[model samples]
Target: MTTTSGNTNPASVQLSAQAFRDVIGRFASGVTVITTCSGGRNFGTTASAVTSLTDDPPMLLICLNKSSTSAHAIRESGTFAVNVLAEDHVQLAGRFASKLPDKFEGMAFEKDGNGSPLLVGAIAHLVCSVSEQVEAGTHYVFLARVEDAVAYPGHPLAYFRGAFGRMQMAPDASVLREVRERIITTVNEVDQAIDLDRWAAELAVGVDLVHRALIALVSEGLVRREAGQFVIAPVPESIIFESYTAKLAIELGVAESTVGRVSQGQLTQLRQYMEATFEFIKDDRFTDPEAWIQANERFHEYMVELAGSKILLDTYRRLGLPGLNARTINRSTYATAELLNDHRKLVEAYENKDLGAVVEVLREHADRPRQLRARERELFGRA
Candidate 1:
């Protein structure tokens, strides 16, 4: 690589070691633990510098730091196993990466045909025999023929920008939902920094995913990142009031399109869902915020759902109005009469084909959350 700056004569700009590493680290790759047995002693080291060269002859290549003892062990043994790690094998990857004197101590593993440790729980294991070696600057490149390969059904662990993570074979949004659910049901005892690794293990996901979720939460006002650590933030009134106002905007537009157009059948569904919200606030259900939240969501969702676009309805749900209720509305003292009263007026307006009244009712309905939030603020002094 070469560089020229500010129209100067093209002079050689030697890439600094940090610059070289920073540029190369952007190319994400699956992590592997290379294992070999030299003189009847097991040796292993974590590697991301591996690739499939070709399948015509089952060839692959791996680059190892020339000074690595594991590389020397593979040279003496003439054979090695590439243990492609699974997303959950984070600790195992760390164990082999460290200079712990014995990476396989007190661990159970199966040996491949060539006597290399087939790390248990790896997503795949490829036993290979070194066929050729090439000297690369500061590293040794081994061209190998795979003697045996076994792949399991699992996601591969990934390395990128000097950090461990997981590769996505397909787009996944479950991590966002899982992290939100975790925060909703969980109560933090101490206001301390988040333990990203602990969250990953609990959620059975990569720490990278947990880290992404926490970073996103910072913008949502549900978490705060201070000095490289995360702490849960008090749920902000802005997200709450803004969410309800957003729903009102969508609902008002929906009301303009679907006032008298709503069929009797859809009206009945609206009534059923709306009335169910009252059911949850009844004596046996007053404490069940979850049930009330579901009923409330279905009631409002049906209104916009009448707009007849799955995409629009999906967009509405993504605003996550029910989720706001989940985060708030902690005690049974939550007064629903006023909110449900607005629902009744909304239904009456829709039945009568009164668009003006429908719009008026929605604007008023959205203020219910602000009222509740104000009451909450007065109770807790949360600013």
Candidate 2:
């Protein structure tokens, strides 16, 4: 609506339009693909502006640009369905938001009760009959009565700053800690089957969430899947030592191939990670086990990444040295100076492009873990 008064300033009116878009664009909204059928044809477009109008009347409102073909179709058909997208539907949302000639081509969807296209895997679907519409400047606002609505279990897709993403809620850290602690203490016997349901009930978490944590444990080499069940993985000295041996070989190869050839930027990053390697053992004493292993892995990983082999990097990571370090070594008594010096020497050798020194340092560094493991047994009185 425009007020045609002699007092109306044209400049102010023009400024308001641009100001309005800039202001409203910062507010995030859930993504939806509005669908309708008209004249024996299917029409769909991705929509960002939608809100529940009233629950008592089961009505909702959606706004689309005046040029939207789907909006015209909805008006003609007098019905539409708003398919609220799941987080995984970023590509689907983009496809519909484009100017493609056939947006619905090769897409899997079913018709809602009102005969509007309901997208598969959507988090929610609302079938509506257009009750009224208003033309507001460059957009059309449709107020509809929701005839049928159903919602599924999933996270919603979010639109912000002209980009598509997810509205994520990070899992509680305490829950993760509890799950890891419980699994480590209870599943002492190697190959013992893990009871996810019992853990969920005891911990007051969802079974699916517990299962997610189990997968994380598996990647950390703390759990193994066998016969369609999760089981405690054996992390004896032999297994840990074998992983060290494997890591040693891969690190040598990466160093020999990469140290002399690394760019200056890579060199700077190497130094950064090398300095972090001792962050957990700054005062020649072990402070945080998790921080120690993470720092240790980051430094070694920087070396391996310099080799530029995704396959090699992936193989090195699958060894799960960080997790194994936590399991094998006892805290409060780990050798720290040796690790700190080894990282320092490796960085210095890389700076000088001395491949021989690199290999020499890595070889000696590999033996330190064995020495530490022995020291750990002696100090903690654990065989």
lDDT of 1 at 113: 86
RMSD of each: 9.3, 16.8
Which candidate leads in lDDT?
A: 2
Q: Write the per-residue lDDT of candidate 2 for residues 119-163, one digit (tens) a residue.
A: 889999999999999999999999999999999999999998778
lDDT of each: 0.82, 0.83
Give, for candidate 1, the lowest lDDT window spanning 10 residues.
Answer: 1-10
Clashes of each: 0, 0
Residue clash pairs of candidate 1: none
Clashing pairs in 2: none
Q: What is the lDDT of residue 42 in candidate 1?
A: 91
